[model samples]
Target: MSKPPLIPFSTTLFVRDTCLCLHVQRAARALARRFDEALRPLDITNGQFSLLMSLNRPEPPSMSAVASLLAMDRTTLTAALKPLERRGLLETFVDAQDRRLRRLRLTETGERLLAEAVPIWKQTHAAIDAHLGEAASDRLRAELLALT
Candidate 1:
């Protein structure tokens, strides 16, 4: 089979400089890495911490609801839940009224873990905000939310 032509270096530079998605994704990965390193002592990743925090609501949320809130698909959310569930950090049970529906709740352990993660999150977030400057940080957050 014939080989396909490679993209030009100029195209790479253009995408690197101008692609919003690329920039956002790169920033997201770096931010996630920072959080992951900080949370390593707790044996959790940034995504896991976020997942657990989302379950901190007053009532257990259905799988679909949690998935929607996390901006994750059902399969991805379910996969993410596995380790936490195995650790007894959360539980999933069939809904009483709807057997086909499953709901998620943070266990006592999960709550405790989340409580521990809160201060760490606060510290890291504070550093980030400070680095970006208070006004810039707030503005950046507002702009990102607008995108969503």
Candidate 2:
């Protein structure tokens, strides 16, 4: 019987060192945890807060658009929206122009909640930036954007 080839634990040094997906996922989870705690008082999770902020823009986006922006699938977006809709923080309506499409709109309560959450978000953002340093943080954000 021939002996099997020996494989080192870290056989691929480059792959081990530069695993962007794993690093991004770990960092994202950590950041989400911090934001979730900060936004708890507003009764929103980090994901919900991001969805609301995306919807807060001048144009009320369709469900598809919102999903695209969040990089979520329709089913995932639907699941996320249910709790917000139940909490009266958001409303979905059939677009008049395109009856097939559903549009997401922030409710009055949602706006109020977002307003309350903004200061907390600012605090979180500032703390992160301070920890990372302004230039380094900005560069990190730019690099992340480039990857996306």
Candidate 3:
């Protein structure tokens, strides 16, 4: 009986350097942290800011629609909405036309917070694009969208 071989540090380095998933995940976390810090005074995480922004529409979106757009499951979306609901930043209501569906709406406070966060998002996003090079950033965004 013999033990299996241990993974090598070189193999780990190879994956760290070449794995798209690892790189994307790391980049996502880094970007989230940067946006989170910029958005902290508004008391919202980056995810919450995106969630609230998705709700900024002439007509409120149904829970299903929001879940789809956020690429999250309904249960996860519901859980995410809880904090905002508690803070009175958003509300859920039974859809008027569709009795069974729940729709989400940003409260006045949510709109105000989102309005404030927009500038921070723009500045951070512009810096990211500028650092990446405008053409490269555009192409990267297109490539990423293709993945989705």
Cα lDDT, all candidates: 0.94, 0.91, 0.94
The C-alpha TM-scores of every prediction are 0.92, 0.90, 0.93
- lDDT at 44 for candidate 2? 86
Per-residue lDDT over 1-148 for candidate 1, one digit per residue giving the tens place of the 0 to 100 score: 9775598788989988999999889999999999999899999999999999999999899999999989999999999999999999999999999999999999999999999999999998898888889899899789999999
What tens-digit string does per-residue lDDT give for candidate 2 at 47-132? 99999888897868999999999999999999999999999999999999989999999999999999988899999999999999
| Colliding residue pairs in candidate 3 | none
Q: Is candidate 1 or candidate 2 better by TM-score?
A: 1
List the candidate 2 regions with Cα displacement exceeding 4 Å. Answer: 1-7, 12-16
Q: Which stretches of candidate 3 lie above 4 Å from their native place?
A: 1-8
Worst 10 residues of 2 by lDDT: 7-16
Top candidate on TM-score is: 3
Give the clashing pairs for model 1. none
Residue 96, candidate 1: alpha-carbon lDDT: 95
| Model 1 CA lDDT for position 84 | 96
- Which candidate do you rate higher for lDDT, 2 or 3? 3
